[model samples]
Target: MTVSLPTISPEQQHALQAVLDEFGKTLPGCSLTVASDSNVLFDGRSGKFDALEEETDSPRAASKEDVLWFASTTKLITSVAYLQLVDQGTLTLDSDLSEYYPPLREATRRVFRGTDDQGQPIWEDSHTAVTLRMMLNQTSGFGMEFLEGVQGWKSYSGKGTGFVNSCKVDNLIHTPIVEQPGVQFQYGNSAEWLGLILPHIVNQSTEDYMQQHIFQPLGMRKTTFYPFGPEFKSRLMPLRFYDNEKREWQVLDQQMPGLTLPRSREEIEYPVAGGGIYSTSTDYTKLLQELLKLFRTSPNAYPKGALLSRESVQSLFQGSLPESAKGLLAHVMNMRPPQPGDAAATGEWDWSTGMVVWTPADGRRLGKDTAAKEGGWGRRASSVGWFGAAGTMYFIDPESNLTFVCTTQMLPGDHPSVSTMRNALEKQVYVSLQA
Candidate 1:
């Protein structure tokens, strides 16, 4: 399923190791690995898989194949499924969703005009319609209602209840686009809608469709939306995080919504497109390798039997946000009344289907030219950066045909250390490759 690269010189391998060796020093309880098309250049960890257990270090070092939540990287998989359906002509990006599904017509936009007499944020109606494309790119303009207690309805799927007051419904794809669609990118709960809609298109559950079409064909033995049975539990690593302030690793007691690690079948929530796929670095990389095939194949003709065609591959990766996305993100950062006074007044980041892409101007010191599409296409542009979450990060460098996946349960995901780890790894990786 994954392409294997030809052997490199021992000098190159040693250079690679030397770069990772320095990086291993920086992570006390984490795993770092790099892989090329043909071989794993490095697979080593300085910390235990169960970080909270002091006795579990060194001898219990993490492996590259250990099952961990890929977090939002799951979105890339979901996007692939959606794109596959698109390729099959099951759906169109710009079609009015409500026209196809009346339940979507039932949803409405809720704007926070200001606070009411009780001091809660006042809301108003927004008539903007939602679309499949907006859901995929996060530009449908939905906010994280769980954090703000937006008073949304709940779903009782027996697994658990999540606030479904999303622009999309809790267990349905009918929740209204509460914010103006196509205006700007805001984190929304459309992955559930994606999961919901894809099944509608193919008449198979999202999990089953993905399992049959993507996972089974790619030899992704360990990836799943939920527990298939007892064996699935055996390879799953426990959930834990490091407390920088306490200088210690602890079993994570305070978990976030949609977190699937170390939980029971009844305790897990429905697999949202944005999150909720338990996977290993190796298995997900296999999926990535499938995409890489699109780029590496001569591209004159579909690679005989490639899973997806070159045109769909280009469409999947080529859409980008408008010029207004940056300004809208900056406005949201500025308008947050409780934001720290010293916080930067501007923000930089955009969506590529389900992944977060960065441009050269976005401040990534890419060692080579990225040649990223600027716009004039759909809002689904691509970037050679990453799509990650509170516990994990995956980065792809198109110029070098390189990808790195870092898994950790670090909380408040935007922590300085996470960025530090990504930066250090990228810097070393480039240095090693050039050497």
Candidate 2:
């Protein structure tokens, strides 16, 4: 297929480079790549991936070729896999999810009211059927790994607050319906559940499933959910974070992730559907290009070699949060974009299948005002697609036909500096496109 790549004027290219330079000054390690419908407009890597080397007056420069931890950005990729199952007739999006995994069906019958005399969660049967659609939209009643240490979830996990590892449950977090499904949006566990189900239904681990279908088909040789294979360099941009109190950056010494290709692959206890992919901007961009073609092309004439069918692709962009879910989202006021100024542009977001869909306010423009069709930019007007975490972000702008993938390895996922750099970088992309 011939792709007419968008050409950035020389002035726009220089401006983009300056924007990257500004971020390099603030962030110790950062890399960014932006693409239009057909080609990469700007791909910049700067600063040092090794925070410790800074103290010794030497640092490994972040390179454009580096494959970083994808974190939650993997969600969008996994979302495509789920819809592929729908296209293959292996699973219906609306089918009772439990029809494939009997355990999920059994889980739906019970509700976690409180603890029993044995301190285990007491369950009462409920009639709610867990559906694939609900799981895709994050309405599944599942908790995330972060909830492991939270007091409330720990108590719910039946392990005391000091619990270090997963208790009796299969995954780190408990898997009962903490909240009623389809009533509102709950992330984290829904993707995990889907990740768990796919392997069971297909009798192949999701890592294998994705490689055979999404990765191999799309020519994404480096993208995977587990350890880097022997063909690939073992080096990954090490995870690091700024220690506010110590006023220094530190590398995170975390356990090697679960899904390794060979000897290390056995270490993977489970695939985290929500956040476990390891990839480069190049490999991931291929996936985004497929989605971009689906977004811009006619439904009847769907782009050839697209990951999902026309119906599934259309459904993906459609927001899943109902009006009733708005109030629940309101309580999440603690959420903020990476940069302080970006909260306005980025905060007016809604949950979609596996991405956050951005919208504008009524009377005022949200942060970065982009074009919309038919009317004022309301929730239904313009949209954004992404899932970000641990200093990694993949944002797709349907309006401008732009996609941004920024990767940095860091801990305490919500670090203001990490996001500050990301938000600034994103704002610059939109501004440059307006040129």
Candidate 3:
């Protein structure tokens, strides 16, 4: 189902341009693009591609080819890669994680048994075993603090020392499980562990398997697990984040004095699969497009060939959270409060694979229903994607056959630039569809 590109109305074009301009003024150095099912509706960039301190005030133009780190957005890729193995019968989703890593087999399954000496958990040992499905859905009883807290797990710090000393994959196996596997949703690096498991099953390194099976086949030329040499540096846009003290945004350089740089090859080459990818908007969009095609059309949706069966895709999207997870991990993932008409009030959503599965009533939380009413077309549901630690986001909307990508560089995560850029782009998409 190839759709023809729609012509943009003058009003819609002006509205989009205005929003892009505002993003430039507010974010400092950033690039953005909005596309319909058929064609790019808007593309714009402002700020220097390199370190701002080295470049002049004359902002360098961002182009379609400029690559930006997709960050945690790489989780979707890791998820798909794992699913491919499942499809090939290399591993089963229900397989016990302890089967591969034997130490986990004996690790205590800790459950909340009330408060302890320091008001911590008084855990009781359990008989249930953690499985691949539970880990993929973020119900593996892993603690979120390892990734969220400032000092908990500094393995992916890019400093080269923390990963070797304190953040090794083996360390996670002995870490306490806060809840029973498949009991709740606590988003973190479980998927990265799953990535580590892939190489063991397929008899190849994660990078090699991804390149041979996914990236090369899908034509994701700019996507890589580790940073490319200086040749690729010319294509990368400098990361930017807002600095409240200066009342302006600052551009980050190679040293990343106050920003997040791409993870070093040493950090990524290890089993830290969850957040190791470096990608461009173009490369990431292709992966999203492949997922969109699978969900909207058929499992054999790609021009290259079928990546996974339709049934497999359905299984990936179904709920993996258990009833006991209600108050614990769910609150973290569902940050938005229940709106007046939210289906979550009726117990409709559940954690599935690498994203939250939204029922129709929960669509408002993601700005989908509002976009539809405003005449913007995209998936109100039946879509899922995530961003990197450094303010990167992507989504594939099956309803409208639209794949959206937004990339930026910001340190410490949760920088205002991410939300500001996403909201502006979403509004423009809505306005464009209405026109």
Candidate 4:
């Protein structure tokens, strides 16, 4: 099988640069890498690191080496690691997770049905068994802590909110399931459970296991669940918040709540599998490129060995949602912040093993709906991508044989500015491909 590598021409590079320059004016700093399966097409950055910009006397230029908190982007990596267990025949996606982990069975898996008339909690025992597929694919009924119902459950149950970002098992046990397992897509602490159970399955700490299996094999040397060490403190990109009223980027006084780096060995627990990795663009790209290669190749012709088997890699892009959950999944994806100057709903969204998979809406496939066809951030149908809470976005388009990673350190992950920047960059990637 011959796969011709696509190159980004000078004119296309110029157009991509223009996107960074245009949006960079509002963001504190951002870096973007566009690459083919085997080569980098465009690698560019705009703005300055807040740490350097603060030094008014002599501002140090922001380098491409800067590390950014990947937030939910960490899920893809963790998902791959868990799938590796399946590849080794140690775990099965459809097996009841409770049967494998007694803790899950010990904890009551009740569905929160809201308060009774007297303001008392109403709960229903869920007979539906939770599976690894449900957990990784966002259908485990675990609602994110920030969601209104989940927060209400926390208050009613007298559970502390700090566990939301603490990377503890309490994140899953203490949190209530909003729906029955395998019924709907409720994005929350489900991935955190992967972090909790993965160590037990592999007989080592998640950090050690990932370091041995994923980080080292993929050459992600700078990526880690623990990024607060003295070694990383200097290279870490500071978190920033955009002040809409002030029209300027402000360095956040504190990092996102519940995020703490361990100073001593004993203090380390399971790393936050949902969103606790810090990585540079180059380091993260290696993983994407490797996955892209496996994605495009047949099972018999997988190029270099990867963390996941070719079958597992295929699962990453294939829709895993049941018929019952498709509507909810589409609604959730469509709820993203509106891109500037663009007024079309994102068509037909699905969750694969890890990330969001954009597909053609019913009408789009028949060419009856023009808007649905244009709504996938300019990436073709079946493109897979997801966003990080800290203003980071990436997508891999096998149809175009291109992948893109853009990172910025900003709060309120769904801020319009961040989406606008990402949307523009994504659209430009396709434009470059066509040219």
Candidate 5:
């Protein structure tokens, strides 16, 4: 299991360093890492650990080991955990989630309808069942309030209450189904519900169960559901915010200015299985490496391994969303922007179990001009992975045996600074490979 780290060329290092420097100037404070198969090709840090002046007046440079929130990236990890149970024959992928929890049956049969801000019918009902498959594929029609209804649901009081309630298999019976499950792609709170199911089926706390099944087996020492100990403070990256008016990035300070210091570990500890894991780039990379290995080894091919059966992995990569669902998710991701005299531009993409799969030529949608190489073809087309709300992203390309993890702490998800830094780093990495 000893992996020999790859040697990074000095030229590659310098190129990556230049990208980081440019990002630091644009982003309030940032850190990044680029890794090939076994070795970290490039690692760079700039700015403070905490963006707030009161937290620390001086800029705290980010470190390779800084533990940052993975946000939605947690979904991938949670999905893996569930698959482990499937490996043990303790769970079934296609089993109506309601079979285990009756309230979920409602989830399977519900239809969601809504009125537009202008009192016009925005979305109509498309009858479908929200199955476990749909939830995993994100085609369950569960809308993500974080991105869509951020303003209204931002103040929703019940943070983890839904998970707590849904943990009871019986709760599934009473749970209201909002939308037809299998028809449309909606990145809602489905993963959180799935995470809650883990504890119920395993009869253990989610953290303890995942610790034994995933973290321990994979040797992801720095990855955890909650802040484990003092190590968190040392590894935690400072949260930064973009001051659009000032046209500058700044550390988040509650007293001096800006909003509160976001949520603290003490305030929320359920370790939202959907989006609440904090991890270092090194630790999270281990998870990605294991997944790559899983694909390489071609294990049981279904939900029957610590990772996934090669076949299951392949199925997960296959686009699961129908045309309707694909269109819905594209809108939710803001992948399409309104153009003059035309409807919002939509691309041909589909949601897999835990990743986005692109068919041939889909790279153009993401603004890529060239097609990917054979082994590297998936880089711009078919791939699976997720990024955090705090500017962290990782992608695994089974076709190329490549995995990349980039970490930074930028607040207000999708800040322009974070996007700029990520795009710059990704472009350099691709350029280096071509060279």
Candidate 6:
């Protein structure tokens, strides 16, 4: 199952570049790479690595080599790492989390009913058992400590919200459950919990395990949860916030909120597993390509051995929600403002292992009708994809046998500019593919 490179005509390349320039011009910087398995079809970039400011001498133009914060995109890698554990019989998807970590057994599952007349928080005990599957699918009732529901829980319990970003499991474990397990889909602390508890199961730091299992194997040298040293800083894109009044992007004076700058490599302790990795578009494309390979090829196809079995990869891509949770998941996906020139919503989405399982307008499943005319706006139905909080996004489309990675260093990831660029770029990629 050797993958051959797909050729992009010169006309198609030019058209893709034009889309990048037009849609990506406003942002501080952005890069997009579209590929199938091993070879890149198109790579285009626009804007500068840093927004031009009075203090800036010469801003570096955006390049494929730029290191950008992957933010929540790190969750996919964490998910992959844990799935590898499952492959090795270290744990199963149904493994009760309490068995590995006893605190979960003792921790009371608290659901916030609402506020009482005196502004006190009403609560209920959820007796549902937490499972690895529930954690990966984000149905574990974990709420982000900084968000509204969890914030109220913090006030009511007198527990500080510092644990959300501190990356410490002890504090994170104490964060109250904001909903009942297996009741609904809430994208909160589930990924972080997956990452924190990983070390306990593997008897190694998360960084080491991921390096040995995922990053090193995939040759993603630039990707890491702990991105330290001057070399990384020199290439890292500074997080930027757009000022509507000034009509310009402003560089954040400090690291993104909740992230503390590491003084040195040794100072790295609790890495924010959910949103802490820094990576280049090139490095991340390797991961996407590897996933595509796993989805399309068999085990013996790799002489050196694949990262995970095909069955494991299938589990990662398959939708995990039951009928009960689909309504709530759709509501969350619809809350984001639609990107300009975006595809019409099918009003359908569900959580896979660590990605969103989006049913394309065509409703075609992979391997069902290979001859179907690939009718879809962007991604094919059932494609597994997710975005970083800092505007990075990637999707592995098994139907088209393609993978896409777009990177930008902007805050409030759902900013219309970033979202529009991502959607437009994806549409253009499909256009080029058709050509």
Tell me the tens digit of each residue's lDDT in model 2 across 204-261.
9889999998899888877877655655564566666667788777655443222111
Q: Per-residue lDDT for 1-435 in model 5, tens only?
A: 223334457887788777877766545336555555455566677655555542454655666666777777888788777666666777676755656655555444544354457643334344654566777877665556433332122233223322221222322222333456676566676786776666667888888888887888878887876664776766666566666777555656541221122245454434456677777777777877776665655333423434565655566556767777767756654542112121223444567767665544424323343454442312555656666776787776555456777766776657655666666676676666555
Among these predictions, the greatest TM-score belongs to 4
Q: Arrange candidates, best lDDT first.
A: 4, 6, 2, 5, 3, 1
* RMSD in Å for all candidates: 6.6, 4.7, 5.1, 3.3, 6.0, 4.0
lDDT of 5 at 381: 54
Flag clash pairs in model 4.
none
Displacement of residue 300 (Cα, Å) in model 5 is 11
For residue 191, model 4's alpha carbon misses the true position, in angstroms, by: 0.3
Answer with 3 or 4, whichever has the higher TM-score.
4
Model 2 clashing residue pairs (backbone)? 109-126, 226-259, 258-268, 260-265, 338-419, 338-420, 345-367
Worst 10 residues of 3 by lDDT: 158-167
Residue-by-residue lDDT tens digits, candidate 4, 145-196: 6677787777777764565565555656666677888888787778887787
**Candidate 3 lDDT, 1-435, residue by residue in tens:** 454444567788777667766765544335555555445555656544543543466655666666766666766777788777677776678878666756556543555344545644456676577877777777776656434321222232322223211225654444455556676666645765676667677788888889998899879887776666675767756566556677555644432332243344454336356666777766666666566556655435443457666656665555556667644544553443222232243334556666556444445434535435532234356555565667676665555556677666555346555566676676567558657
Could you say which candidate leads in lDDT? Answer: 4
Q: Score each candidate by Cα lDDT.
A: 0.57, 0.64, 0.59, 0.75, 0.60, 0.74
Runs off by more than 4 Å, candidate 5 = 1-8, 26-29, 53-58, 106-109, 112-129, 146-175, 246-266, 298-306, 334-347, 361-366, 370-378
Off by over 4 Å in 4: 1-3, 51-57, 106-108, 168-171, 251-268, 303-305, 337-347, 362-377
Off by over 4 Å in 6: 1-6, 54-57, 108-115, 118-121, 166-171, 253-269, 298-304, 337-347, 360-376
Give me the runs in candidate 3 sitting further than 4 Å from their true place: 1-14, 33-44, 106-115, 118-123, 146-174, 240-242, 246-263, 267-271, 298-305, 316-319, 326-330, 333-349, 362-365, 368-379
lDDT of 6 by residue, 1-435 (tens): 443455678899999889888855567668888888868887788877776542476666888767778888888888899888888998998888777777666553566765788998787878778888888888888875556877776666665445555555555666667778887788787777777777789898888898998999889989987666666777777777766667766755453455433334564456767877888878888988888877877656643457887787888788888777777777776766334233234336778887888764458532223443554356777788888877888988877788999877776667777777887788778778877
Q: TM-score for all predictions?
A: 0.77, 0.84, 0.79, 0.89, 0.78, 0.88
Please give, for residues 406-426, the per-residue lDDT of candidate 1 as tens digits.
655445455566555555555
